[model samples]
Target: MNLDLLLEQVRSTSLLEWIAVTFGVSEVLLAKRNKVWLYPTGIISICCGAIVLIQAKLYAETILNAYYLGMSIYGWIKWKSRNQFGTPKITSSDSMDKVKTWGIVLIGWVVLYLFLINFTDSDVPIIDSLVSSTAWAGMWLLANRKVENWIWLNISNAIAIPLLFYKGLFMFGLLTVFLFVIAVLGYFDWRKILKEENNELQSV
Candidate 1:
């Protein structure tokens, strides 16, 4: 893409896209810091993102964002239920939770893939469904502060970067790059926190 054309595209960007990108960045950074505010920020981002994806004819993505809105609210409530110390509890997923997480991913992928193929004109149904389903599973894990959420989220971010770029959504594509890096850092940060918490429990 030409520099002038890219600049023109940026200038022509809609308010919703800008809002989505802004809140999206805030949400990821807050997540990295283990802040409770991430959910509300995510809700705002998803609301803007839903409109933008709808306008772009990305029906799967639009529906995913709508789901994200609900997930964000649920995550907020769940995260608010802190431990005795009034801190949000974090944990690693056990074997059963891991199995259930992957199961959700598989089922969501199939359902969305069929929905997109049968009901919509999505040109990239496979990628769309993959991203949406994995993200759904990731959000579920994230609500409970499971360490594996970062892994699944990064998977979605990696796919979303190229997908958004191909769709001419350069801003969101760049945002995904930022999200990808942050999620990696988040994994390490949360892992360290979990380890320290475990150590404290053992000492007690």
Candidate 2:
């Protein structure tokens, strides 16, 4: 793709895709900063993504995005709920939560892969399932404001970048790279926030 052709495609991009990308970028940046606004922004991004993926016949991705929609709503509710003392703080996943996250990845991968192999005519079932499953687990952790969500999300982003480029989606590949960097930063930032929260608790 030459520079002129890429610019043409950018100009030709659907309004919905532009909206999706715009909200998606905002969502990730807010998430990196541990802002509650990410969920609402992400809900819009995920909805637009699902519509775009459905039009492209990417059924698995569409479903994954629908899952994100539900999780985003759930996350929004969870994030907004505060106790009387108003102390809903950032935290790391406990041992049980860690086990559940891994379980989601492994089982989700198998179920999605089998669904694709048995039902859909998808050409890239394995990698697609891996990416979606990891993201599914990551979204679950993110809904609960877990620090490890960034780790799981980045795993999906790393796999997805090459896959998107392989499918000739250079724009999406670049977007995933941006997301990968933000997730790395979000991980460390969350760790720092978690430490501060723990210290604050200790002082009381």
Candidate 3:
């Protein structure tokens, strides 16, 4: 297979699409490095994605993309203000906090599913809702510099791959497939970075 063909397809995109892809690719790299700037980059990417999807007539995904744009903006501001000097301070939490966060995420997913069912006419409303809610949680957690965001990201991309294909976005489906693999690798990479940071702190 010619990888150049794939690159050409993406390269032929409109200006907004180009910006969207650039920001998205940057977000992925920044996310792997646990950088705070990823949130703002995400906002630009999602805004572009929303335009592309809406034009393509994938209403459910279009709405989700719009939501992502708003989410990225909110997350960017939140993350920027959360820590001193705008740097994420990696820290461990107790079991109770972890349980509470997970519980909240589960409940939020269920509620979001119900909400989408009431508002959207999509046949795959449940799956759509699940993906949106989970991705929202992942974005929120990432904004807070939480380690578990990777898990939610992995789950979201897992669902999104087939969903995009079903919606006839062959290129987007391929993109999500790539994202899924990257998310898995990102999980381990961030974990290792975190451990290394901890060890260096101990040594000092």
Candidate 4:
């Protein structure tokens, strides 16, 4: 990679892409800390990202970001709900929940793949749909405070990093790498929390 060219690319990044990157990073960091503010930050990020992706002709990514915006709102409300202990709770997903979540991913991938293939001029429809579907399932699990969300999110990040870089969205690619690390940390953190919660309940 040419240093001068990389610097030029950085300098030439659009305002919307900058906003998307900024808030997207914030969203992941906040979520790692189990903060409620992640949802609003994510909403801002994806809205900006949608516009940037549309301009880049990543139509499936654009639609994925739109879905992200809606899921952000749903996540916000869901996370705000209180348990009987009058606190927000994080929990591990049950076996059946895991099965159902992956089922959604499979169905979503096929549907998105067909839609992008027929409706858009996307050159990487399969990869785009795979990323989008996994992300959609991950977002749903995250909203419900399921620890398995990190696994799904990491899968999406792995696929998206190369795709974003290939599309010349270097900044977004780097951001996704950052997000992948955060998701790994978040998985362990949430698992610890679940263990503590279980211990507390058992002692009662």
Q: Largest lDDT belongs to which candidate?
A: 4
Name model 3 segments beyond 4 Å from true. Answer: 1-19, 55-67, 78-86
Per-residue error at 172 for model 1, in Å? 0.9
Candidate 4 — what's its lDDT? Answer: 0.91
lDDT of each: 0.90, 0.87, 0.71, 0.91
Candidate 4's residue-wise lDDT over 137-184, tens digit each? 899899889999999999999999999999999889889999999999
Judged by lDDT against the true structure, how good is candidate 1? 0.90
Global lDDT of model 3: 0.71
- Report the C-alpha lDDT of model 1 over 36-109, residue by residue, as the tens digit: 99998889899988888987778888888887888888889988876678766789999999998999899999
Which one wins by lDDT: 1 or 3?
1
Give the alpha carbon lDDT tens digit for every residue of 1-204 in model 2.
799988876776678887888899999999998888999899988988777766655666777898899999999898899898684677788999999999999999999989989998888899988999999999999999889999999999999888877765555667789999999999999999999888988999
Off by over 4 Å in 4: none
Candidate 3 lDDT over 1-204, as tens digits, reads 378966776576578766776788788888787776887777778888888776654555666677677767776676566455345565444586477556656776687667657765657767776777677667666656667778888888898888876775556667677777778888888788779878987999
Candidate 2 local lDDT, residue 35: 88
Better of 2 and 3 by lDDT: 2
Model 1 CA RMSD to the hidden true structure, in angstroms: 1.3
Please name the candidate that would achieve the greatest TM-score relative to the true structure.
4
**Residue 152, model 4: Cα distance from true site in angstroms:** 0.4
Question: Against the hidden reference, what TM-scores do the models get?
Answer: 0.95, 0.94, 0.77, 0.96
Residue pairs with clashing backbones, model 3: none
